[model samples]
Target: TYTTLDIQNLLAGGAGNPIGHLATPAASRAPGEDEILGRVTLKYEPTDRLTMTLKASYDRNSVNNSSWNYVAFRCGLGSGISQLSGYACDNDKFVTHQNNMPADIAANFPYAKKDGQLYNRYESYAINGNVNYELDNITISSVTNFNRNNNRWTCACDFQSSNNATWATENSTWRSFSQEVRALTSFDAPINLMVGALYQKTRRNFGQWVAFAGLRNSAASPENQFVATSKTSFTKGETTALFGQVTWKIVPTVELAGGVRYTHETKDSFFTQPYNNPGVTGIFRDQNDPDGLGVVNANQTFNNWSPEVTLTWKPSRELLVYGAFKTAYKSGGFSNGGINSKFSTNPLADLTFDPERARGFEAGIKSTLADNQLRLNLTAFTYKYLDLQVDFFNSPIFAFQTLTADAKTRGIEAEFEYAPRAVAGLNVHGSLNYTKATYTKFPLAPCYAGQTPAQGCAAISAIDSRQNLNGAPLSVAPRWTGNFGVAYDTDLSSTLKLGTNVDVRYSGSYLASGFNNPLSRQSKYATLDAGVRVGAWDDNWVIALIGKNLTNRLYVSGVVDGPSTGSGTGTAAGIPADQLGFANLPRTVQIQLTKRF
Candidate 1:
């Protein structure tokens, strides 16, 4: 017996007349988001060993945005806001001099229109316990868990006419508590063992006015026709972790598993001061405790290790096979608190950077066919990396180097299932995958153009180590993906009941570079989904008709760099390319109802 209840609401909309992205100027300033979700689960067992479970959850999300917009290269022209209206001198950093309009409309178009309001709240509570013990040859088992989580976020923004006008108003509160302890052992000979350990911790707080700003750009510019002012920043960090695992059965079809884990981490940041422009000097200093950053001591510590191994084979029992080796690590960070960096008086050395690595290998197969109505599984993998911490554009770069431009990934995964229970209740499932990532050696950073006789004021550096990135592919990793499903149940004779389902997914073409800059590409798309169900009496109803991107294909996920290098390359066009995507959710229809006690 099973009981469940769920309620979901989501609304997203976009209606013409809003376009801006000549390299991500907040992408026309977001506006549309409303979400709500509720769920419940319960299970019970009367005797023989004891089992009970209960879970509850709720979430609410809201957003109506517009933080900053005014393209055309903040007013210099490289085609953004799609050039807003008119200004094209054959593009690519135009040059034909004066009275040509496209210089941010002669400098007074100083735009900053971002209206925002946000609310987020989530709640969850869970309890689960299980026990079974019998000692004859040795059989003992126990499982226990408890969970509680609560989160909150509030926001307000407006940055129109400079007193900085509130732009970011904030509040954040989070609480999490969890516990898990388990033990189990059973042996008859042929070598057998099981052992486990796990622990966790979480704490967070941002009381109120945590810190906020919607969008900004203004180091004060209006010369050679380039005016600027756009800013949007928000910060919060708090975390903790603990983990462990093991299993072995040396013989009886060979089964072995091993695991190791160790982790400890902490981070803190709070900032709000420096709305610059009256007399700028050294990182725009103007403070009175917008979370204080001058001598307010901050701390960071991290240690991480994860190791895993598994090998299993069983010639029979429906044919099974497995192989795996794993090691993963990601930790090391700090930066993003603002203020201090006219070139640093040292705000912790303007925030530090380092930490990123992964090593993995896997192989797999599981099968059952024809005789039992078909079922299959397959897997293949490869990963080796190091120090690859990249976030470029939001500022953070270690520059893709496994050692000297090393990052090779391989993948192949497949799954299939078909059930023909004489057609009484039909079912079919499917999955397919193929992944590829490349970059054998990438390093070549150099810039600085025009007016060079003694090279003193124009400079850009980091020249050569080796580069070969085969021109884009591996920005969200999607070299081809697939999924399919269909299910049916017929029985409208007693108590009236009928159920139906359908699902399909396909993805190919992915490159949303976080900055390796290979002509900036993000193109590839495919999607399909559907569902229907109905039940009477005890009450369970669902009338669903859902469709998304039923082939409304138009791609561009993200791209960057169009300026900001030495800022003058025959006209400057080396570090500016912007396009961010996943913008698909064009069709929708829904109806659902469920109840049980």
Candidate 2:
């Protein structure tokens, strides 16, 4: 697959430049990918009450692209015109450009590099086996799975330089094994029960290397080129769990079900980084540790219990209502970098984050009306989260950090499908959702840069404290979302058929940061998609012409607040005030052919 990207504001003149935009057709950004997948399955039944199955699959994917973000240089340009004077702009900002172009006024203007060059390759394979036995009203099953993956990635940190650009490479290997056993019982009475036990183990090895051209050139010899930094890490984890569920038919039209699961997990990790030069440090490290002896070795264990209860009522043959309450939790883990690297001496304590827990309640109804021609479903839910984990990039330190906070979310979802009995192969469907999510209790949260005490920043807080986000809306949580679509199909001939579909999707504006900065919010936007399909040979083979985002709507898919280029100081540290991230993909059209065997 190949696709082009549009980096907004890659040029100094935004969209009014006469020389042409940065992402013009002649200089459009393109990314390419190739993937291959294979799978096989086998099933056997040796007896009336016994069955066995085996499955295996493999996948490999390779991706190559330019920079993910077109970071602009902060050079001061007197006018947005072409000039060749090297002294026309401040050298401090002009030098930030990675390309080899001369530091002329024209070159100083923000221009997105056409080639930054990043490549990634991933390969994985898995095998699974299942066995089942049944006797009378009881059934037993067992499953086993093993998987392994290898990943490699390389990228140029600086795009402008031909042979002197900064670059990084990472390699990772992961392996996992899992087993599960379960038993189910169904009695003559109105009751059913199931119990299961599961165990899993995983291991990972990762390493990264970074180098700079300037440092390499400064080396004593070409054979001893500089190696700014290198990192090596290893992790191992194991988990054991037991779960059970029971359902009882309390009455002719009512049923109640309950389930519980308990899990115990253990994890161990080791990390170390070596600085090749005594004066040089890793991007995530703020101190100069010449010995490169900074190491993180830690082990931790956790145990959790989750439970759920549900009540269902079938008021009639065509109508059903249900309510449920559940409690869930996610395992805690150690941070990979950021603040954790800064506190290398006690990484276990400073870089570790607690598990996330949540309690939720939901009620929903499902109904079929108009002689089964229409189906509708509606649901409302609310949840309270404790220690919700969040990840943010720390511009001040030029690293990423993981944090936890408490939050609450309430939402409603509705969906409907209509197919008039009078018209065959004609159907309409749609769905709508509304979400209200906010931080219920959060202290010591980082405030947006430039935010004052009166504007929600804490007057006096902890070392890293910024704003009090107790009531701020959750990041990426849009309030309103909806989708509508219609499809029609008809017989074109005895063995041929034609089908067409159209869909519209819309989303409301919402904040993109925990600090609720207005600048980080993305306004509402909508897109339309359409497709036509032609089938032959009793629909065994089909071809489709599909068009997505037909309107060519320009919008941001996501945002991360920060400076467009180099890190800033003071209140400008890390905030979405600067729109410098990758833009969403433009309109796409494709033709697809599928066959069934």
Candidate 3:
């Protein structure tokens, strides 16, 4: 595959921005990513109206400094720091009347520094054939496609310390195969119709492993070692879809088009784990002993019917308008581990969850101007979601739940592009985009206060009450987001040509909701990127220089809050507040060369 574009990405660790105001200090790790890929294609044309093709593709990706990190300190009774007589006065609960031990340990434990490593490999092979034939007053065509893909990923979290070393590791793989066949027929005159039916099946496999140990001299003992392993398989899922479209020319320059597709999907999955043995201990089982646990099994199935309708209008050659209503479905599945330790006792029966569904409506306009050198497009959309499933970090009090109630989203997006034809050996192009997203409803409240293992079963009565949470904006997703870029190309001389591209993006502040409740919000920031290219040998070979996040702006992209839908707010007052702050990507640069023969 050829390099289509010089793209730059910015990263910010969970902190987003370095600590500038907090009395506590802040630190971050470096970030970088490099990728190389290749593909091949084969085609056969046995007849003028028939063609068959096959394609194979492969990719490898490696990234550094991908782990999560943070900074913080604590001061409390368990800190083991002996305070002056006043220190004992400051906290008396944990100490004698004269010893000021705070009611709770004042822990200021700093956030951990994350150094992440990830390896990914992907492969896909596909074959397709199409045939077109004319019969009397109509033209008919048949098309078929078969495709298979396999993906593997391994990632690790590095502690980067001499002691207190801990690591979270994961290994996962997915394989999918599918086939579809359809036919289209249209009349020769102004009236035309196309109808088709398609069937597809796919399967996926998933696995994970995690291990960690401290750096102490004797930390490797059986009690100190920690590890977990799991495996899941989805044997087969089927989808059947039917579609039809009709177009009336009305006149030579004016035409109207309408189409609809109805799709039914059914899926089945099986999960098993063989590592639980008798030797496991602590809050979780120990996978190191094969006899500690027995194999666990789970089965799940779901079916959904999705519908879509679209209309296209073209009054002239330079403009087009379209509107569509569509419904999309994502298969439901089960989680291998349950929220409570008690659920682990019956692993085979407790891991499965349900499916989620969404419906959307959108309308947009596209137009070209400036002698076809400039293009602009805009779309507005609104969607309703039922049984939305969200994943969150489990907390000590209320357990995490992946299911969410009714939700709604409404937003609009616009993109504009301008490219000037080469003039006097110089060419230039620029583009810009903007979008806004919001949530119509989010259910949240405080669960059992001062109760151990909080009972999160609580309902709301007032739609506008602080707990009702209607009209609250969705966390993590920025309300305003956009990017702009401009590029210029020219020949410096006969043997050398130069090109430069620059792009910038800005994201609005958003609340972190990884913990399930909204906490503090991160500040907004912008980033700039630039690159230059030089070429020789009739432009067959070229060297490029790139710089990313030139501004070095610090920003956080996401945050974690306490539990939602449950009363166990993690805050000091049993209130939910944001926690984890997903840092943004850092600035980086690279030099690359490419050659063609």
Candidate 4:
């Protein structure tokens, strides 16, 4: 194993971008993932005018994942902070003089370690059925759907890589069912009418156990290796909606339509954490602890009336134009996620936020030219969002929380397709997108670990904090994105065909954090992919070879501050917290086969 300083120096002066170049083997490198998926569909017709269809699917996944350890150094400016709480520094600017080790190394380089892997299992089952009956002037239809999901995963909180041994696990389950009925008119008049009504209900539950680190490894002493928390939450939701639309055919080539939907929704939420145990974990803790004193029960109701209007005109058989305006809202819900403590004020009032709403407009044009060999489409859109749900880092709690922010987004998208008549086997397509997404008002955002007073860090309370991120861009909302692809197809035989394609995808730089963590910013990146396939004319069987990220670009996808010391506070905030990021998958090539009946 390489020493701490050795790896530190190699990680670009302790910045640690692109750590894959290091030759050191990982401390732990085993991850397991298994999945099963199946789907089936059936169709029946009793008469030409009546038809029915049913579809069902099931998916199950089991994953055993782990996190590797990383060394940390105490910062020179971090004079009064504790050793393991919300503190980690290894960058050159923050490392203290390493008088505790050989060669006057600045900062202590404690070797990182991990206890075990994280276990997660998920399963989902779904069923859908539809029936349509056609009459003289109107058609009637009904649709029904049901879904169930079960999941359990280890929580990725209390992350510390330097001797901060902790682990947490959560169990969750969800189920929902919905039914909708609709009627449509097909009269010979210049106008058509359609209407539908829907009803749905959902239920979900989650429970978690947090094992905080203690001085001893034994569970014999009730307080040692204590289970910091044993909490559970339950949520139930119901929705009823009625929607209708009317279309007016102004002419053979023009049409105008309007639609409106009214929805009533309700949420029943409950959360609790037991205080009946001596805070012990595993075999020593009581799962049936009677602690009604710590429970929080909450309920919420919402009503929304969404409306939209659209106009479409076809100037010719080869060209079309369309424009639309719409307003919609998302339902509000309680935030009984994790554990809630009575000491933390009213849990419902503090965590629950209003429903997000949006009003937007869009316009588009589509054209086909060059004797139908060339096609182009362009669209532009803008939306004003209020009370957008935002998950942000909280330095005091060392965990992220859900809040609300006001935001806006505007964008333009263009796509083109070309199929040269001269090149009978070749086709080309590409798209370009530009977006601007920013928070208009977010005064209560959390600051990065070490933001100073001058940078807008302040105390909401003795144990809470806030920072102004009034104009920050939305997380993961890149300003620009584009893709280009080319494909060729040829007949190998009367019964067989060959196809090949190549594509390149690109994205502009963007911050990966809602709070705008400097270390979590991602620069622009692009990837190339290619595939080749051979298949029968009927598509009864096929074989293909595909390669992804052929350029092997190791771009960061997302970031989370963890391993133990989550978001740093106090003296630890003076230095940027130890950042943890996830990278895109490496380059790989695989062969796939498919057969259909």
Residue 168, model 3: Cα distance from true site in angstroms: 3.9
Tens digit of per-residue lDDT, candidate 3, span 1-597? 000010000112311111111111112333234566676677777766656666656555544333332210111222322121112211112111111111111121111122223333455555555555555545555556666665543322222221112233333444444444444555568877877777777666555433322111123333222332233344556777777777777767556666667666665655444332122222233333244333434444565666666677787888988888878777676553332222245444344556777899989988997888878888888898776665643333212345455567778888887777745333343333343444445456332222122323233332111243345555566777788888777787888888888888877776554222423355566789999999983889899999998886655555332111113232233322213244554567879898986
Worst 10 residues of 4 by lDDT: 97-106
Ranking by lDDT: 4, 2, 3, 1
Where does candidate 2 have its weakest 10-residue lDDT segment?
A: 1-10
- Model 3 — which ten-residue stretch has the worst lDDT? 1-10
Model 2 alpha-carbon drift over 4 Å, by segment: 1-29, 66-116, 156-166, 217-226, 282-293, 337-346, 395-399, 449-454, 458-465, 562-577
- Give the poorly placed runs of model 1, Cα more than 4 Å off: 1-249, 265-279, 286-292, 302-311, 314-320, 323-329, 336-363, 366-475, 479-507, 511-521, 524-558, 561-597
Q: Using Cα atoms with residue i matched to residue i, what is each candidate's TM-score against the true structure?
A: 0.26, 0.82, 0.69, 0.82
Q: For candidate 2, report its TM-score.
A: 0.82
In the range 460-481, model 2's lDDT, one tens digit per residue, is 5233435668888998799999
Tens digits of lDDT, candidate 4, 287-360: 34333335567788899999999999998989999999988798788765643533333445644557989989
Residue 247, model 2: Cα distance from true site in angstroms = 0.7
Per-model CA lDDT versus the true structure: 0.44, 0.65, 0.47, 0.67
Better of 2 and 4 by lDDT: 4
Residue 12 error, candidate 1, Å: 43
